[model samples]
Target: MIEIKGLHKYYGNHHVLKDINLDIGEPGIYAILGPNGSGKSTLLKSIIGLVNPRQGTISVNGISVAGTHAYRNEISYLPQIARFPDNLRVFELIRLIKEIRNEEADESELVNLFQVESDIRKRLRNLSGGTRQKVNMILGFLFDTPYLILDEPTISLDPVSLTKFRKIISEKKEQGKIIIYTTHIMNLVEELSDHIILLLEGRIIFKGGLKDIYGKTGSSSLENAISMLVDKNGK
Candidate 1:
């Protein structure tokens, strides 16, 4: 389980997150939604211990993630955009990630799943934007770790690739992994999430299942409910 208490982050005098408290358990998908510059990304970074919060406590399965090796090995994070070595080939990138994790992986399975084998020899600089996103997605899920955090994971994906990625995420969720996805796609949230956390400014305005959200907002669709909530809060 992942627990957060009194999480706050600031950049000099600018506060990004305020008194954030959340608890996420195993075998569930949590979709975090917020407007631009609402501290959504900052919260995700803090959860992964990539950015230190001014005041907070974040732990995964009883282990603190702030500068701890044990926590590092248990979580995988995929940023909104990824940069890879321009000279590295597709196969080389996967090979490198597998080697870094020190885990033997069936590279072909991942390659076929993402449909990137034809471009195995292509360098990162040569691949298109969607292909690079696919590569990034593969790296995040390759280790099969307990926790996965993906930020706008489907931004540049093509329709076919996006479908494959959705299936992969569903499989991971079924495996009892804790998946926290930060995305603006409400349709995806409705289809994939077990719960949704809605944020306004730096505070969480709402947190609950889809049915609860609909009931609260008097709307049946996820997008309508989110729009209602965000608009009401002046987001």
Candidate 2:
């Protein structure tokens, strides 16, 4: 389980996250939604121990994220943007990450899943944006961690790959792992998310299922509910 309490963060007089509190205990997909500067990335980084909060506590399972790096082994991250040396081939990057992390991986299976075999020998500079994203997906999913954090994961994906992505996400849910992701696609959220966390400015204004949002905002659809909520909050 992931638990957060009284979280606050700032950056040179700008408050990024405010007194945020949350709990994620179930095994399902949870979408974190808000506008561009709503602190979604900050919250995610905080949980992964990449960003520290001035005041608060974050714990995964029973381990605190304050000063420990071991807890991160339980999480696999798919960054929104990944930068790599253009000279490296696709497979070389995979091998390099596995060596750096010094953890067992099943990347061969993932490569097959994404049908990225032909491009494995191709250099990073040679791949298209969507193909590069496939490589990113393979690297992120191969670790088989209990917690997966994906930021803007579907960006630049082709339709066939997108379909495969959804299928794999559903499979992950069935395997009883918690998947946390951020995306602007409402239809994707409606299709995959078991719950959602909405942030306004630096605070979490809402956290619940789709039906709960509908009830709270008196709106019938997720898109309308979010629009109403953000507008009501003066965003």
Error of 2 at 167 (Å): 0.8
Tens digit per residue, CA lDDT, model 2, 70-159: 888899898888899999999899999999888978788888878999999999999999999999998889787899999888999999
The candidate 2 region of ten consecutive residues with least summed lDDT is 104-113
Each prediction's Cα RMSD? 1.4, 1.2
Clashing pairs in 2: none
What's each prediction's clash count? 0, 0
Tens digit per residue, CA lDDT, model 1, 1-235: 8999999999999998999999998578999998888888888988877789999899888887777866777888899867677999988988888788787867677788888888889999999888888888888877768889999999888889889988988998899988999888788898999989988888999999999999999999888888889899882
In model 1, residue pairs whose N, Cα or C atoms come closer than 3 Å (at least 3 residues apart or on different chains), thus clashing, are none
How close to the true structure is residue 38 of candidate 2, measured as C-alpha lDDT?
Answer: 95
